[model samples]
Target: MIGRDAELAFLRRVAAEARAGRGGAAVVRREAGIGKSALLEQTARDASGMRVLRVTGLEAEAELPFAALHLLLRPARHLVDGLPWAQQAALRVAFGQGRDEAEDRFLVGLALLTLLSDLAEERPLLCLIDDAQWLDRASAEALGFAARRLGADRIAMILAARDGGNGAEPHLHGVPEVRLAGLARPDCEGLLATVAADLAPEARDRVIEEAEGNPLALIEFAGMLTPKQRAGHLVPLPLHPPQLPVVSRVERSLRDAIRLLPERTQRLLLIAAAEGTGNLDLVLRAAKESGAGLPDLEPAERGHMLRVADGRLRFRHPLVKTAAYREAPLVQRVAVHQAVARALDAEEDADRRAWHLSAAAVGPDEHTGDALAAAGDRARQRGSHASSATAYERAAQLTVSPHRRAARLAAAAEAALGAGQLRRARTAAHRGQRLTDDPPVLARLATVAAMADSELGRAAPAAHTLIDAATGVTASAPGDAAAMLATAADDAWFAGDAWFAGDHAALRRAANLLESLTPRADASLAPVIGTVRLVDGEPAVGLALMRAAVPADDRGAGTIVGTYAVFSALMTGDDDAACALAAARVDRCRERGLIGELPHALQLLTQALGCCSHAERAGSVGIPAHCGPAGRWAMTGVSVGVVRRSTRR
Candidate 1:
């Protein structure tokens, strides 16, 4: 914590504010070995009376959905029972404690928030997440979702993550950040003096200089020195070469330390690292399978590489785990994964076992690929879309058949889209497209790519892609083709007036295609038909269709069709209908714990409120334009100011 007074003060203030019922969160970003974890520990120690919860991300569990969250909330599981039934059920399903798999991902986040708030009702809560960069995508997204909405609750979160390295947590982007740099020269000298008091002054100065103020480097490099080197009788090798980053050097030093341990101990350490969950029993079983035993772990413990407590094993630092796993030969690593997979309960831990099996495989194996694909299905059912994407992608890699590979890639693309990973969805879709010529698979991939493109603001191309996909699917899958046409019309609307003015072809084509579909009086088709009518200059028919689509109750109000109805009402100058529909959407979203939809719902509500002369209330509920889809919609002549002014007249 040396040279971190300012950063400490910021974290302390956040806790203090939360203690006073103003909850907040801060993400601590820094390179490895720069004391991010140390700072988190210090802050936790400083929070005297607060309820503390911690989750340390493990590399082995990075692909397992909700692993980090499961660790963080294990102690607070009892509090979840008091939450609303929807939230409670969501949490149960997410944590694998229930059979119902219809949990919404956002509902899981909401459940976490509620549980944390309940825990903080009696005492302030401090959540410390270390090595957040290694957290699974589902865990990271859920944490971010809850963290962003912390308000008037005695809860504070501080997430420490590595930056400028692999495994960046992009989901945590919107949270407030406290960036850590190297310590100052004076602080580094003082720290070195404490750790290496008897070192020669010249040698100490050289260590301090070479460490570049990185706390781990300072400690580990000094620890590596012999008495002769410390006494200036022998010069230490310059391990911190300019070409290698300090963090890399520190990792190498840790690996070297691990190499000094007994071979059996190293094998035990590798099993522990590969297990990732710190399940002592599982690790021991896996180690025994590799001819290592509990006695071998003593060397690792004495070396300060890892510790065992409460039947669980934990590495001293994330780097220790990384070094242990990476230092092992590939054959040994694969054998460890296979051992761990064997140790897992076949029925209960199928997902983890499948992942390990996939990791252990060196070549195409249809059985393993099928196992991973089933795992992907389970992840998707649990609403862990990112985890589903990873499982499917790995399954695709292990599949020898081109058609199976393409199908898995399509599933991955769709799952990635659900997880809000736009670039990954697009890439997977493109790869799938190149692998398959089947019309159905190609249509699915095209649809996924188009949806991703639309979200990424390539609306014109997205509209064209959707139109083509719909055309390809029309003969075989008329229902899906109609849905695609409807989506194409929505994309054309998202393209805005500028694109509409420049080229009316995409809109005309969408309208023509929808017209060609078998006539149905379904409410789901109202918005698309209304949009087509508007494009064809029949405002009366469009307005009537939009009005018919606006739901009379909450049951239908929380749907995408309802969202389109609100927008259509606004576009057709029906402020009263827009306001009512938008209000209902917001309320339904909150009541159902649909957090992903809430932001856009709130935006629409704010706009509707603004149009109804409740501008002050709108301001209070308003989300920044850039933060929601409303900003893009504003380009289509439905801006707040324009609506407000028109209504005022």
Candidate 2:
């Protein structure tokens, strides 16, 4: 393993903070053969605790196959090993071949996680999944779920991957990265001394210099050297030989793993490596068209055939894939590809449809146009909206018809909007509408653009245009009107100083518009409606109404309970308790990234600050009286205009 004391020190600090009931993340990166795995292993060892679950990357796997996750989190199975048979059976039914299984899996998984957290002796749970680059899409999703669901106090995760040479690895960017560079010269020399003590000083220096202080390289280099700089077992090293390529080592490991698999399995895996997605139906058809036979072997001996529920499956790692794909012959690839095309014709799966369409549409001398469009439609139905958008974008690029391209952009725009991607929605809407003057489409495009600008605090020219569209639309399409109102609110609320600069009539109009659009149900508007009322200079009525609205909910008391406390505490001059309750409320929202509630937090903090100032000695220059200095003193800018932004923007 690569030893870098400094990198380990940083990871330790993060671990320490987590131990002390805080959360932290670390990211690590380096070129191939730079001892990334070595560092990961060391960190994992250091992070050992009562519930340490480890998952490392495999070399060749399908891009996003679901079953690979079964390998990563098999530990979750044992968690149910001791549960009652009925519960276990119910769980099986939940995570198994039925739609309802998803709910059971989640609930049972949550219960198990909670139990584990409570039962663990003293050590915290550390889930380490390494070599994230080759992670299956399902595994990535599981990571997201686990991050939010795992024990808040006892669980932390460690992920490791090689540098993708741009920024950090995309998958690992959400958490922290702990980069693993080359070892220091002293560490390199220390490692060498373990292998061969008292080597010539010149040779040791030469080894360190040649390895660029990379421990693995120095160890491998030292092994291949002689007492002199002459020829040796692996290759004679010069006094100053250049660093050996680690890719070759990675390459050899991959080749060996592939060679060891059964011949039929290897061939199928090799074909899948080239296919990229390795989606079963497509690969199987490719094999059939290529005239490859499925051996009619017995179940016990032919486990590879059913290793995953999906017959045409991916291997576990990208390195395994790179090795096999690099070695496949051209003639074999063409035959398998013919099979793939035939499979696309036969099967009706959505992801496979998109994949096959993508493959055929872009391939040499193939007519990709019509098939690509057909596949794009199927892709959207399969809940692969993002993938469908990609297919449509490619169609836009390859097809010559302006009308067809506009249609493609429209599909892409809808997908973007459904995905909560406002930026992409704005772009696609703008482009698609520009190419088509169809009034309805134009109106839709105008609505999208206006909402996009307004959401980000900019004034838009399309508010009235969208309002016109909403009125023209059918009664069944009230959604359009609702969207337009929300967009207008967003624009007005987020307009900054421009909002305050409106003329008297304009201010009254905007105020009425906001009041009309705000949620009418008292049940929903209790805390926040009262909040705006107080801010609008009617403090007494606002406080009384909010106090009446507070009720005990099973999910914890609603916002009104906390708001009432802050208001009452401020009025009664209980500054310390007021600040404490306000801070706690703010802390809870902050944890949820509830930026919409920040203005409420600010208002409460402002009141608490006022009470504190009133109690302070007159000579003291600290927290001032009134809401002015109080708001600033209590986490300035922490919650400014959050509620106002939602209503006005």
Candidate 3:
């Protein structure tokens, strides 16, 4: 709280921006015990009246994917019911509350953003995180992902992390950090004097020297001294005593303070620490089982180590929990985890139970892995792709069989891709590929890689990926290979990437591959055949075949076939047909909630509309021999092909 005026001011600015609907986030970085948490708490106070949500990371649960985030968002669970079904399912899957299914992880982030935006419509929202260094990978990525997209939402986030610590994950790189340094000399001296007013001059000087500028260290060290020591009864401090980090010394002081409390009281505090989140009933039950009663918690509550508020036991600072658990014996810590897991033993809460058991497991266990996999499956079915990926990844790690592990890893990779986690998808894919060379597994990896490449606008690589995959699978899965070739041909022709756009060899390869496949009576076939014919000097024949492919009614053709029809019409110089097809595709995309696909449909519609307008403008003079870009490209290409064939004859 002392010497943090500038930091507080920055937080206030963030809060003000969020309140005014221009959301922002600030990452407060400093070493442990440097008052980062204190500044965050002050920011929460400064932003009074806003809906505040607090989540603190615990080292114990840092490996549990989404643990910190689940705590951060649990209060907003009611908002899930109002999200789109996919998003709703995604959130549930992430939280382990629904059936597991592959879900777009961004969908969950979008859902959380939308939920907060919806809540902020009534009042601003403030989110505070302490010890962000220990936040799980998935939660950290998701939060950073969501934080970057909060421009128009009424949300402010303040994250506190130890600078240069193990928690400094790359996801935190872009977020602005407010590096907190030691308090000023005056502020440090003033705080010490205020807390230990009766201290003699020499003892005060000694405390200040050892305490340096760390506010927590100064206060905790001040409280550690006896009246006699404060009165200069202790020996004068050496000029250069063995130095320890202020945060470490502060933790040692906390450990000494914990030793002064009664055994049962200390045990109660340890139980609270092990549980992490202060679900009052669960903690109370765990304490009771540990032979402690409500009376035992009274001392810690009175001493300000914790407080009971609104059915939750809130820690004064997250460090208190860390210290409490850290000071406990290794066996004692294990016992407490088991006790907490036992207390949370509800069949309906299998995912959480599995997690607790996973934590308590001394070593890898296949049964536990099976439980997690089952939980993941449940989550996936509910459309929680993020959670499903996490569970599957962990399950794969725990599996004993090489083949099963590889298969699970592949599933995790696919789910990560579905969640739009490209880096994670690539990692999982590479790991799976390292384990096996099964055709199906390779196909899945290739599909995910190709999709990621296409989404990232690397059209050439994506087109090659599809073609190579098709070639690899041709003998074993001819139908699938044909489908892949069809996609490759489309990309090679119109993706607009230099690698594919002018790669005549790739186009010919795609066309030849499609030609070799046993043709099926599928709607997509017309576009494939027409595309081949158009580029093969049979423009009229290609246009006729494309026209025949169009369904009798808009309802029958569907968007995919309809979209191809629009392009074919434009190529054949039928402006009216192109306009009608493009308009219908746009309408269908909108009706189906295919928002991501709507832009493409709109782009085609715009081209079609422009062509129609130009055709009308030329009506009085008769349609121009050359019309739009597509028309010109088609006419020129076909004419050149015709001339070449005639010269050969």
> Clashes in each model (backbone N, CA, C under 3 Å)?
0, 31, 12
**Whole-model lDDT per candidate:** 0.80, 0.51, 0.71
lDDT of 3 at 316: 77
State the local distance difference test value for candidate 3. 0.71
For model 2, what is the C-alpha lDDT against the true structure? 0.51
Clashing pairs in 1: none
Which candidate should be chosen as best, given TM-score against the real structure? 1
Per-candidate TM-score against the hidden true structure? 0.86, 0.54, 0.73
- Model 3 TM-score (2 dp): 0.73
Question: Over the stretch 1-649, how does candidate 3's per-residue lDDT look in tens digits?
Answer: 6688888998999999998889988899877778887788788878876999898877656645567878888777777687656555656766666645433334455556666777777789998988888886667766776677677789998888886654336667788889887877788888877888888888777777777788777777777787778788866743234387777777777877888899999998898888877888988888777789788988898777889989988877666787898899978877887788789778765776666666666766788788878867765565445666888888888888777777888788877776667878878877877787777667766767776676677656777888887787777887667666666666666567454244445667776776677564355557666766777667887778777765433555534455667777777777777777766665554333333445566566656666675555333222243466555334322322222122222
* Number of the candidate with higher lDDT, 2 or 3: 3
Provide the lowest-lDDT 10-residue window in model 3: 639-648
